[model samples]
Target: MKNSVFFVLVNILLCACGASANAPSEAEVFSSAHTTPNVLMIVIDDLGWSDVGYNQTTDLLETPNIDALAQQSLSFDNAYAGAANCAPSRAVLMSGQYGPRHGVYTVSPSARGNAKARKLIPIKNQRGLKTQVITMGEALKSAGYATGTFGKWHLGADPDKQGFDKNVAGSHQGMTFHYFSPYNLPNIKDGPKGEYLTDRLTTEVINWIKTPKDSPFFAYLPYYTVHTPLQAPEQVIEKYRKKGIKGEDAKYAAMVELMDTNVGRILTMLQAEGLSDDTLVIFTSDNGGYRTTSFPTPIRAGKGSYYEGGLRVPLLISWPGKIKPGLDHTPVINADFYPTLLTLGKAEQPNQALDGVDLTDLLLNQQAINSRDLFWHFPVYLQAHHARTDQGQDPLFRTRPGSAIRSGDWKLIQYFENNEFELYNLANDLAENNNLASQKPNKVAELKAKLKAWQQQTGADIPTELNPEYDADINQKMIDKILAKKTHH
Candidate 1:
């Protein structure tokens, strides 16, 4: 886990400043047959439920290929991105716990990793995911799986440093600015000329699968599609433009169409390679799509906000001959994926704390979990670049820290710093437009206590150094390394 941060830091630095001029090559490929089942996790960025045809929106944005894939998948109707936004959500997703547990409560553009630097003023007071935490890749690798990550490696950036055997074209930046020929500031690998980013990523996956390996493979393809810069090929945009759409809506629609097409290509490769039946393909987005381009009408709030739209994301799992195809309102959170995958693959978990439950039995046996609570903590919203801020900030120019506790139909959203709260019965009100807290004071109190207890258990708090460590030793080492290289030249 400590090594994970180095990779993340490298990637973040690359995304923040561009890829390294001479970034190291991917590590040697490992065999995959020794592992139980190969896993392909396709995570789309900022995609909305309405964007996919399976979700049934009136917008008529067709996603035939994705829809077909979903038909055979265990669709999750109430899945959520662990956090309202990306980085923090990914921290939770990777650690199989809430962000607070990992000390990654929110996205930190300046998060650190080097130990020599850690000895100095310290790495920001903001909680970081400790090296002690376990990641899905590390766990699988320990179990003899070949893990490869392609596209958008935003959990600190360096996938190889984290645990991947092979990594191609991922960075800390949310999405590559150039779709056709993508490059990060840190490790710029130019894509084949005219090759779109989405198609290129899928191509890399297909190639990885073709590698002659004996161990099971874990391919984490976090697509940078349908996120931002909303650029698609002219042909794609024209395909929708000729259909009577224009401006922002048309561009957004084109991006969605392209995203679906690329996903289909991956599915086609799986079928062609005869790996579909043996592989477990999980498709989900990090968070809801941007509100301006996508509609989450039935669900209030969009990305960066605590409302359903920000956190609610589409989830589908397809393990042929394993999971039965159908919709399940079984309220499982992102953390559930951790244990669920381990259980499904029959892999051993490390001796450590894990917040996610294995939902494999639920998916395969049609069993119920009875009652389980899902939690989310967002300490701050710092410089949100991808999503829009709905209004001018409060007098403090910052949003307050907030936490949520959800069990069954009841959900309580609490803003800790401001002492504001909202409660909703999702079974009755999916939009979350009505605040039931005032009407259900007792329920609010009960949930507040639960949320507080969980916080105590997790021990999540902004450390004293988070505010003052701009020139911390870690960043200094990064600077010194850069300068030393220049002087040597």
Candidate 2:
């Protein structure tokens, strides 16, 4: 009888052990997790790294909503836009390729302006994303998720042309004169006169989220605030002016404040809809701040240049219950958004080669990002000339439209214009204040070879011979007109 009791006890212990082994551990669940999270890409126009409250580069600006969102999200401190300007960067974000590859190099003009003027500047062949290539919107749409875009669809003339099912306030134009006016390009559903453009965009987003809680969605809100011809409602302007800000700076600050408030409203809407946990919200700028006086802090140079300030922007991603909060110091680019969003949606990736990697893995798993080169090409430079201001002299000779190849901490800027070169160890010098090309001849040569090799592999289009006789100034008025129509009303 004692022997029988011992056998039964041993069997009971074995059964308990088996049950424990079959149970799922938290780590195991995290490893093979597949949740179809809705994606909200909130793209702020011309916002700098210092503009957001979390980065704290400027006390002149207030972004409480963004700051609160950052607390719950994984913030990328070293994130960069694909290009220094709007169109190219937006193109890169839509298609997981560099600006040079997709052919949308320059910013789009307002729809009402001269088409002949556009031919002269000829947006970097990278302007129009190839129809054959899949966009993030297309991927989500195919997966039964509704895709809607609210503002600044600079990817193409029509969001329908690029795959967005709903495109409100979208246009080919990249700039606007007033946030609210009848001046908007004809296609968008223009709001009432005197309406705040940013506020209208937020209302559209909130309405979309409220109606579509049944399936996943991808809502892209690219605001036209703080770009150029900086205009804001007088009420908002007075609010900031009371704080000692006056003139154009105060108007710019007011626009940013309105943008922040609207963004916060959208976040609040997501929470109210009870979609915060199942949705992923991302806030980033197309490029750096357009204002030269703007502080990018550790980075040097502003928009229209290849400096860190021109490329780097604030990146905040909030995925409740999935992403661990706090800062991610690793470098990320706009191109990564395409692949990362598709991966999160559990959609099939395109067969072609993509320049961006799946950043979600890097953010969640804390895995070391594999060393990969990032490249940029800007052929035409537009030095901004504001009304009657000492806008500074244009460089005597334009640098030959150049290209840069960054691997690890070393970045080599190759000026094809004169075969001139500049190199920096970005690890130590974020401002790019020092040029080490002459000191490190061997490293320069090595990086040059790598850049050339990549150009060959990617089949990058070398600048074709064009007559220097072609003048870009002939269309200035037309370009301005097109830019003005991007606002509200």
Q: Model 1: per-residue lDDT, tens digit, 428-469?
A: 898876888889999999999999899889876532333343
TM-score of 1: 0.81
Please list the Cα RMSD from the true structure of every candidate, rounded to 1 decimal place. Answer: 16.0, 9.1
For each candidate in turn, the TM-score is 0.81, 0.84
Instruction: State the displacement of the C-alpha of residue 416, model 1, in Å, after optimal TM-score superposition.
Output: 2.0
C-alpha displacement of 253 in model 2, angstroms? 1.0
| Candidate 2: residue pairs that collide | 102-126, 103-125, 103-126, 103-127, 104-126, 104-127, 110-482, 400-417
* Model 1 lowest lDDT segment of ten: 26-35
> In candidate 2, which residue ranges exceed 4 Å CA deviation?
1-32, 108-127, 384-400, 464-489
Q: What RMSD does model 1 have?
A: 16.0
Error of 2 at 323 (Å): 0.5
User: Weakest 10 consecutive residues, lDDT, candidate 2?
Assistant: 390-399
